[model samples]
Target: MKTSLQTTAFAFATSAVLAAPALADEWRLNNFLPETRPESAQIEKFAEDVNTALAEKDFSIEVYHGGSLGLPNTDLLRVVPTGAVEMSLMWANYLGRDAPALGSVFVQGAISTVDELTDVLPVAQEIYEEEYSEWDVTTVGFVAIPTLSVSVFCRDEPVNTLEDLRNVKLRVWAREQVETFERLGVAAQIIPQEETYVALRTGVVDCALYPALYAKTISLQEVTGYASFLYPMASAPYALGVSDALWESTDPEIRDAITQAADDLWDRTNQYDADIENEMAARESLAEEGIVWSEDFPESDRALFVEAVSETWKMLAEEAGGNALDYRERMLTALGR
Candidate 1:
């Protein structure tokens, strides 16, 4: 009983609905930091950016923060290459056992400040691309959250001078940090980030070296009485990597969009960190709450520390050998040292 015009319109609508494609790809991005940290916020921003940029594409990114995926920070390099997870923000130094050259970023005094770290990133990116490719992953980019320094937080007394660190038990993250402390005559213990708070409170370690933002995250200021804003001995290089298979299979346009999103995220996060006002204000708030902030150690002590840590780099380079050694040399040259 339908008119010929009405029947034609009904047929056209059915074909259009059937022709529309469903969302076919979903990517999982794993992050180790809790959602509250700026690092995690940036990761979330990256997801949103990529999704928006690729709105016409049939792909989506879902971020899993705070290790909700049950992957430890150390297992990222091993797990991410298998295509089980589409991407991850991994701490580069955790792979030191197998890739010492990649771990070199965590070597105390290797890069000094965030500006130096930024300057060396091009060379670092090349090294990471070559190295991560071998593991079947594609490097997205390197991220520096906040800045490149770690402050000392202590329970018994303030570490205002290098001499104060002598014989003091401190919690460290990597072998490079341990070697750096050893050179200063301090006892260093490798502690996982999750366990550091309880260890500090229970007196298992007298002092700890961590980013100031992290201290606030774990509420260490409530447990520790002093903090010293020392020049960074080492900064963990954070890298975002995607599975090589996924990268190859993605549409070319989508791939380009994702890359652009990564670059945008890096620029935006660096600008946020460079502002300094937010960080200083947070520190001031902490100070008002009774945390004693010590003056920076003398330049002479910093010089000696840098010199001593440089020796450790030579040992690392020799140990890493082959491409790692080459990469290390390239990084050193890039740093103009």
Candidate 2:
């Protein structure tokens, strides 16, 4: 009886979601990040453009910030396809556990510089389209998350090199990271971003990988005393995924507006690299708060880390069981590896 009731509830939720778009003459875009984020502003602008373009048609695009629809970021793979949300910002890296083929295509942690990041994106975008197309989710545009430097923070030990991480338990965000570190013979765990400081304070994790620009946002300085710039951390931009269901029903004029907005989304951000100045500013701020900066990763170690992470990427692709291996090869060739 309980199982049947749960199934009924899910069915009702699905129906309600499917019905929301056309009947209301409004297409909802679900962005899980808060409105205050720099990227959210662009998304809002995208919606406004779409709504304005469709003004004559009695249709509108509504922007819901901070996951107001109560959707988990990870569930977007299925949600967007099913029209649970007409559109959404899906962080490909965050969805790795579910779509290894797309998610692990390029682990930003594996990349060391902005040029390398640039090289990988075209390949990653292809895989995203190929795999997402398999489920009928269209990749409209992307918001480029700048190449914020990755800082390895620890409470007691300073992680300046690969060898330095050996004695400490690292807290990484994804299983691929956990496995990559594990392959290096270090004990690593997956800790949610919100609980990282607590985990560090309570001795649950000895180190964590965080962007240097936002370390203070999570109060990493309060618990961890030392940090090192480990990599450039050019994370895959948030993908603007639109459902085919909604797209097919929309007029071409409205589609052109969305396409133009998305194309301009990338161009708008290309005006400046948001992280370069901010990361240095953050480092100085963290230093004032008593956080000691350590030597950045040596080229030798960066190369080593890239290799370890690459192995995990291959393993993920092979296990994902589709055109994953083929996609992985294209990614490697793009990287010139």
Candidate 3:
């Protein structure tokens, strides 16, 4: 009788062990920036929050920084679709191959400020789903990485007006920028940010069109002599996307926990970036390191700059399957534009 009772208890124990599920899978996140960059900092915070939430819910994640997963800029769209990586933080412009329609959201003079961006995302989301579905990625969150002011950063000469931008060799991204600048008689080169400084130093490119944050983070200010405040480039915000295959395959409870964690992260990280802007002293500290913030330039120049790029906007809108006008109308309706 004793032997029979022991055998029954062992059978029950083995059954329970077999029925219990395995630990949840850990996710991999990839970004192009160095681990020290502010964008990486924001991502790290998000990962931490998500990991914590996951721990409570019996799931986890592992972040891979600095493109360690071998996702070069060129293969971004293809890589995401093939599930080579689980998630990535990249500029939407990079996905132009798979989804040119996303560019409609960031055309010059199209989106002026962060408030306008937040209001326009609902419409953008609809468009992203249609476009990104082809690429097999889902837009999880759209966070503005502070408002970026575009300018010609040069080591040799100062570009103080719209005419000064003409005939200069500038490094730029996005097809529209290339087309627009070329039309204005400026020679445009499409180069990655990693190579921009060297390009400036070597004179391969005479100048670059990028953000002030580049000055703060990478010391581009020290490398350049002039920063022409042209159209405020606030709309080219960073977006975080997840591989649809991975997301769809994830356990439902784990997916819910991760989505909630992402929501929490967006609030925390964007608030931090915004709070830094609110504190004048903090912004000044960054400015002291060669950042020149001025709207004091001639208002006349703004019109010329806009006129030069206006046709490019129309071209992009037409290319994006009429999304350019649709997005503009949606934003104006939201902002009473």
Q: What lDDT score belongs to each candidate, Candidate 1 first?
A: 0.73, 0.77, 0.64
Candidate 2: regions farther than 4 A off = 1-23, 55-58, 201-203, 270-275, 298-300
Better of 1 and 2 by lDDT: 2
Model 1 lDDT per residue over 1-337, tens place: 1133234433443343224322347787878787878788888888998898877776788888877776667665666665556788877677776556676544656666666767776677677788878777798876665554567889888886788877578988788778877877778889987788899999999999876756677778877888887676325457899878878988888788789888888787664344356657766877887889888777888887787788887777787777767877788787787
> Global CA lDDT of candidate 3, please?
0.64
Model 2: per-residue Cα lDDT over 1-337, one tens digit each: 3234334444544764554544557778888776766778888888887777778888777888876676767667656766667778888777765566774576656666778778887777777877777667788888877777887998997888888788888888877888788888878888877678899999999999888776766789999999998776667667888777777887788788888988888777643355688889889999999999988989998787778887888788778867777877887788888
Q: TM-score for all predictions? A: 0.85, 0.84, 0.80
- Which pairs in model 3 have colliding backbones? none
Which of the predicted structures, 1 or 2, would earn the higher TM-score when compared with the native?
A: 1
TM-score of 1: 0.85
Report lDDT (Cα) of residue 71, candidate 1. 68
Instruction: Estimate the overall C-alpha local distance difference test score of candidate 2.
Output: 0.77
